[model samples]
Target: MVLHDLRKYSFWGLLSLAINLMYTKIIFPCALLVRRPAHIRILGSYSIGRGFTSGPGLILDVLNDNAELLIGSNVKLNHRCHIGVMKSVKIGNDVLFASNVFISDHTHGSYIGDMQSNPLQPPNEREIVCGNVEIGDKVWIGENVAVLLGVSIGESSIIGANSVVTKDIPAFSIAVGSPARVIKTWDKAVEKWVAVS
Candidate 1:
């Protein structure tokens, strides 16, 4: 652990940290910290509150001028987390995201709408269908999780690793698995998480 810490805090690491400080203060004044080497392409707008920090390789993409992404204060996102917004994505305060997590508010083509994109067309060339995603405060999203379009993750919830959240997760719950389901919910009186029976 000590050796790993030393390697992580090496000269290049320190330089990256310094550059991030400048980037936050000057370039992106909304965020308190954004680690360097992040692939951020925001044609739209985003507002991140103070004490927002992200690890290296954080990818934030806002595809169009109408898109908006809002993140509250003291949110921490680990390495390689990607958030792609086409309409709106609001993340509340004190949220945590583990590595390789993806949160997107849009998909390549419309499946439910009448004006669907051509199936013969490439996905990259297809029209984008927009949605909205809202993540409440004090939510802990585990590694490799994908929070899909039009989903809402309520406050004080935990999403297990490798899960794909396709629907709304109620507050004070523990959800897991692909197409994530609420496996347990917090019982305040018992002060424990009781399994969904």
Candidate 2:
């Protein structure tokens, strides 16, 4: 009875190890290829650090040759996170992102011209406004969050769900709402987060 039980446990352990090997060696690489097909004209130049794990449906769109996307170590990105890099995107270590997070450093339509002048033109043909996005370490961005062009999110900052980050968020701040504003900031003197007026 003891030998039988030991064999059963060993079989299950071996099966688990085989599955992990398949996932790391074959499944993950195939998933990346399927998610980003060769026909897509996205040129990606990524400098990723160790311990980076991304869930399914990760899309990396690099619009230009000079575009760069740098992700630091120990970062976790949830499913369907789209990173559109037109200039540069620098993400620091230990950052966690929830599902459907979109970080882009460019805007698709031309803001200078009149809306009705070339309204029928395709969006892809329109001019792109490019900038750089910098996200510091230990930042947490919630689901459906969109970090727009030229925004910098500082270290230890928490961006609430569905927030549209349009500007710079200071370090140790808690920001929420559309066009996210800092609702709370860490006060070192008080050793706690204080409300921002």
With candidate 2 superimposed using the best TM-score fit, by how many Å does residue 142's alpha carbon deviate from the native? 0.7
User: Residue 101 deviation, candidate 1, in Å?
Assistant: 0.8
In terms of TM-score, the best-performing candidate is: 1
For candidate 1, the 10 contiguous residues with the lowest summed lDDT are: 1-10
Q: RMSD per prediction, one decimal?
A: 3.2, 6.3
Off by over 4 Å in 2: 1-44, 112-120
Least accurate stretch of 10 residues (summed lDDT) in model 2? 30-39
lDDT of 2 by residue, 1-197 (tens): 14564476577665654454456444343221122211223576776666666666777777778888888887888888889898999999999999899999998775655653256878878777877999999999999999999999999999999999999999999999998999999999989989999
